[model samples]
Target: MKITLITTGSTADKGPRKVAEYLQKYNHKLEVIFYNENELRQTLSKCKNTDLIVVSANVATHKRASLLIQHLKKLKRPTAYAGIYAALHPEECIKETDLVITAKPAETILELANRLENFQRIADIENLRLKFNKKEIIKNA
Candidate 1:
């Protein structure tokens, strides 16, 4: 699957990079963009054509994450949130993203990539907390 990994300047978290490496091991295409590296519009536009977008935001930039999520939500893009804040606060993250990645997420994300590639249901993937259902946000195991 083609994925766009985004992170804010303040956090500069390595989570996205690690996931990029892991996904690449499985031959998945990935593009990583740091907010400080390019103009917001340019970085965000990259997400539009990708299969999925993974935004990693810690405590310092959940607000920025929310804004980005809101914008993506408008475009009807499939997005997931990662990092400590997302895992710790799935409730809040769900309001912004279609899913929340938590725990040892790399493998689960690989499953998600494959499922997405196959046009299969991704909501039941382990370690993926899905918010697509309004009745309940699937929690991490």
Candidate 2:
């Protein structure tokens, strides 16, 4: 699954980076974007094609994360909240995102990704069966 992780604040912070690295090990495609460097339009555009989006925030970046989630919710896509802020303030994060990783962000994300992948695979098989049935019906008619 393609996953996009957005974080605000200084580049020196390693929480987001570490989460991204762990996800990559599980063969999920990851794009880590530092939101401060890009316009909101640019950030959203980059996220538009991703299967899942995870926004990382701490006390210093929670405002930015909230703003981004507001915009992201409009896209009607799956969004998750991660990082120290989410773990510490889950009630607030739950208001903004579909999923909140209150602890073990990496492990939680990996599980979610696996579930999504399995669902997609099942959907693809169902679609194929539907198409094949349609062709069979037409041929018989």
Whole-model lDDT per candidate: 0.78, 0.74
Best by lDDT: 1
- Cα lDDT tens digits for candidate 2, 1-141: 999988876778787789889999999999988887358999989998999888888998899889989998877677877788877877677667656776777777777777777774322221011112212211100
> Positional deviation of 20 in candidate 2, in angstroms?
1.6
lDDT by residue for model 1 over 58-141, one digit each (tens)?
887788877877777655667888777787887888777778887676787788888989999876788788865666667755
Q: Which parts of model 2 are misplaced by more than 4 Å?
A: 120-141
lDDT at 20, model 2: 86
Cα-lDDT of candidate 2: 0.74
Clash count for each candidate, listed in order shown: 0, 0
